[model samples]
Target: MVTWLGAPSVAALREALHEVAPQLGGGAIVPRNLVPDAAPEWSAATAVLAGRYVVKFAWAEPAALRIRHQVRVLGALKVSAPWLALPAVVVASESPALLVTELAAAVPFFDVRHLVGAGGRARVAQDLGAVLARLHDPDVLAAVSAAAGPLAAPVMPAATDALRRGPAAPAPDARWERVAAWCDWTDRVLGPAPGRSGLVHGDFHGGNHLWDERSLRLELVVDWETAGPAEPEYDLRCLPGDCGMELFGAVVDAYERVSGAALDRDRIMGWHVRTVLDDVLWRVEAGVPMPDRRTAGEWVDDLGARLAGFGVGG
Candidate 1:
């Protein structure tokens, strides 16, 4: 009985969680944390249950694409052996677009961009890697494709059409400098396109992964809404590419190990840098502001640096 509505309003969480976990009593339902740092993408508020569960929801686009992607991913898991130690979906209401998945007795992995730490990091890396590998298996891919192939929200009609023309719009930046300033390894690494065959998680990174709470082990890699068929290297492009190399390295290494197939080293490399510019560009377009409206200059510099690194002097 919660009718979910706009995020950012404190009352929303109260009313929503009360609806989800009525037993806790209305007064006890309170969000543990609120993050205003995240812009148009998402804003979150968490409410911890009495030694039982944690309830959270995005004030951005909750019951829409989130539900769709989750449902789609869950549907795939039915046929695929992901062996994901994920929380069970307790009760999901499609009308208000609220999903009350069991909170893992776990914490979000803590690695730099990952959700885990040193010891926890390795375990999560291995476990998540294993799950992803199975999810990518040929049979699973085929089955998933048939069940629900790469899907973007029906609202974003051009998502698929845009990919064929080349990833949506290279990270919101015009210069693409984020990658260039990072390192020499980037240019040599991001070469030609890798073969595109399997389904991609699309937005693969730490902000979304969580460790299982009960055993303190990493659970299923949640947040699969932006999934779809695309070049295999597509997911790797989202990393921050500054000093987060070690984190990204762990993810890629673990992933290749479980998949039993060498990821195109070059392609993954390109993703490292490309995503930076792409993100910047997206932010500008989405009306997210840079501290001083200097995004244009920033982008040009970023691109220049990248070209210089790649030896593309022009």
Candidate 2:
């Protein structure tokens, strides 16, 4: 019984917001794409309303589905994990796939990068670890599952096609061989299915988190579209690459202490390996530019270095 509204331009979004919540529609509507580099026509978009609230809407069907899913997930978490610093949902609509939330005065982790020292980093890591522990708790997961229905499975890398296609352009045979060998090693390391699974913030990355400036406390976690069930390590996959191995270790240490559970380091490394190569494969095949314009071989070599840091020979 939902009426679909096609992708909305700034004006269209304003109109929809006005229709549902007139208080939010009068302010200046500055559009921001939720997905980086995506066009307004096909991307999920957000707009800041008078610096007090944010209105999110989808332009495409997939984006719309995710928006609806996020609303449900957030509602479930509100009851299950009330103490978590999550955004306050002001209002939402299914027909237009729009969501409105009160904007918090917080910034992404990277925004406060200069303020963090070794001690500061460890504190942040500990806070993150504790949060993850709660999110992964059996009680919370059960509550989320009961309210949100089934959670999505972990997304493993589909490197076979990319391996067959080789690099975007012809590379030295050694590069191809190295890539293939690394993939094989990862497969062997990953081996069988993971013994532990939990509800994970499917896209838990630095950018998705917001922190209070004065306290450096995690203020809010945005973008719940990808939250689901998966190997807990999958949530930690970006820590090594994004925050460096030291912080990665710190987070793991704190996580162990808080959760009172030992994590399998090899499994964590295996997930990291898959995550890095998945990025390389996607960019190579889609002709998207790699970060810093680095060549595929260089990217692969970097992955090897990261693996070696974990005492895993690639």
Candidate 3:
């Protein structure tokens, strides 16, 4: 059992890395917290070693387990999908739960999301679709499951429950009628049966990808802590809402071309609804201010606009 090591300072993490992998000892270690808004005690922290590699270390036990699982998942993918542009794991330590990987030579997807033109977006979308198709291949999923054990499946209804119980729960007022209507729409659309399932990057979003601006391609996918079994649509949930429907449609088209299978657009939209509302619910519950200090109602309005972009909601 790994002991909880409380949150580590840059100096502490550097020392731990040195003790475990002495060859990596000499470097200018810069601390980067993956989730800056997280509680200090449970911050997801990493140390950049000499600008060439990143050392992921966990401060809490739960975080340690996730790191270990990610190490296993990556190890399996290294063999099953060697061509994938994943960060190569250099070393992993069990005691202090440290995972060292090569730093990807690209920028976060967010950096180029709005900067890219239509052609660039199409190229990126195509690449993303092909990558996800390969990742969700049946043989690759089998290999990952064998190595990493059973992965968690996404629960679609949980988002609705969260909104109903969270601080954003609708009250008997016209201002919140939109929220109530959204909940009803989700219930009516999602139905009783679950959608098709496959291996998914459970937390797939712009922030988790590395993009090559010159090539207009995805260089690498990082932060696989939440990778597991779910509907393939789960991975594409953020695209339409965050990046726009055109890019999302391009990705789906590319995916169908590469995988020889058509995707259900409605199913994708259903997951999109869950993803958008879940974001709103979490921010309101945690008292985290939205972008532009927008009110929760305004965020809901944005969600409605995103749905309308897909020609779905009002």
Task: Name the lDDT of candidate 2.
Answer: 0.77
lDDT of 1 by residue, 17-91 (tens): 566556543544446657655654455455654545555465665434465466666666656644654457665
Alpha-carbon shift of residue 210 in model 3 (angstroms): 0.8
lDDT, candidate 1, at 177: 32
What is candidate 1's CA lDDT for residue 306?
Answer: 44
User: Per-residue alpha-carbon lDDT of model 2 for 1-314, expressed as tens digits?
Assistant: 23334545777777788788888888898777545446543468788988889888876776777788788889999999998879999987777788899988999876875576786988888888888877888778789989988877645666544653565645523555656666676677678888677888887777888998988888888988888888787788877776678778888899999999887767777777777777777677677777658787787787778877776664
Better of 1 and 2 by lDDT: 2
Model 3 C-alpha lDDT per residue in residues 74-112, reported as the tens digit of each score: 888887789888887898777777889998879888788
Clashes of 3: 0
Q: Give per-residue lDDT, candidate 1, residue 149.
A: 61
TM-scores of the candidates are 0.61, 0.88, 0.88
Model 2, residue 204: distance off in Å is 0.8
lDDT-sorted candidate list, best first? 2, 3, 1
Displacement of the residue 14 alpha carbon in candidate 1, Å: 5.3
Evaluation by TM-score, superior candidate among 1 and 2: 2
